[model samples]
Target chain A: MTLSVALGPDTQEGTRTGTAEATDSLTAPDIPWNLVIWNDPVNLMSYVSYVFQSYFGYSESKANKLMMEVHRKGRSIVAHGSKEQVERHAVAMHGFGLWATVEKASGGPGGNSGKSGGPGQGKGKRG
Target chain B: MLQPEERAGQDPLAALIGLDMDVAEPTDRAVKRLLPNVVKDDGAASLEFRQLTERSLRETKIGALRAAALDLDKDEIVLTPEGAKHWSMALNDVRLVLAERLDIRDEEDAEHVHLMQDWSQAEDVESYLALVYNFATWLQESLVQAMLQSLETRR
Candidate 1:
């Protein structure tokens, strides 16, 4: 049977997590890590974009841009953070059933641009 | 499709405790798709990560599945934000398992499967699975579109 979209009340308070600020002081070299989302035939395009917006609190446009990149390029680094942070995001993505992997940002295919700001750090844009 | 492993004459407490003495990567392709390696090209590291996190991950997915199942009984299901999240996850997992069973390895395979829409055409197990997979995909797309609309309204 074809399922219809019947949305219930949207009453849950949107909990936007605070974006982690850039930290300059570090004793140990905290090389950046990336949370890469791979394209799959199973996951819906709209669902993937929604995940980016809701979970990372990215803006709609940014989420769509990244989602399109994943669809076209086969993969996209959706978020950047410290190794631990990106690992946590990877776990969350897996829970959503998206194919996600974590790797060092510097060595990955999309090499780090030295611009540390990325959606994975939860850049404070809601909706 | 997701069920707790049942071994005869084994301790039932193992499931409750959420610990297994020996855990290896799942042999089934469908199971592997659900719980994939987090790190690319690093078997040892991925295995270590799986050992640390796979149990909790299984529990989380199961929890979502159970919640979605309960809502299925309602005459007109009205979901809260949390309920929608669970439903989305459950439906997505279901689709992943179906896709694997259908052997939909690429876009071409998915397109071929999409051709099996009519119930009358389902003469084999493979065709039946394809229809089910397509249904789940359509349902997920609708839910996601609703979610995106809500997000827009919130902005």
Candidate 2:
């Protein structure tokens, strides 16, 4: 029912006949994919943030924010997108020596995604 | 605190969330060779050994604690059979290693080994060396325990 906005021919707004399957396969179901990083003992907190900084090119504050989420909340979803994007982030985290994994996001989890919502607001459910 | 259980074919923490604490393994040759000597039944010996073991886990100061990892699976950390044995035996390892290094009199020190009151005086260089050894042991034990606990949590 909702129209997908497109800037050019590549988007083919109305000519959706051929690409429906492609799009459906590309995007996981209603559930969003997430990259989750678990806390570990060997690596230092600062070091984890530093790796996030160096690998993602995120600023120190941003990296620390994600790292804090992981430390305080037990785990945090560092990235989200299609399955491949989440997988890439998971791999990068592992290469950096942080514990990470991927899983399908739950529907209506009744919590903030940690962006607009504060802590205890968008709590990622423990499974 | 108890070590979190690690389930088969899953991340140790999540699957084994409620299982019994699985002990870690021993890696040092000396620790293995010397475990039997630890006075397992003595309350003071367990306390002294635990203090050093916890300390070792916190800090990698002990040469042997650094080397004595059971094994690491995925992200969950657990002690192996050998590791648990090592942990259980470490008290003896500490006693003997420090006893030899400190030149502690077999008779006098043996009777006083796990007693804090005995070392309060620090009457000789040997006693001082015992204190140092105790410190290193504490660092290693603390780190291992801390690592095991944190990793077992979902974090």
List chain A TM-scores, every candidate, in order: 0.65, 0.57
How would the docking of model 2 be graded? incorrect
lDDT top scorer: 1
Model 2 misses residue B45 by how many Å? 47
Cα RMSD (angstroms) for every candidate in the order listed: 8.5, 21.1
TM-score of the second chain of model 1 compared to its true counterpart: 0.87
DockQ of 2: 0.01
Local error of candidate 2 at residue A81 (angstroms): 1.2
Q: Candidate 1 — which pairs collide? A: none
> What are the models' TM-scores?
0.79, 0.31
| Full-model lDDT, candidate 1 | 0.76
lDDT of 2 by residue, B22-59 (tens): 22333443332232111213334323333223222323
Which stretches in model 1 have alpha-carbon errors above 4 Å?
A1-31, A113-127, B1-21
* Index of the highest-DockQ prediction: 1
lDDT of 2 at B144: 34
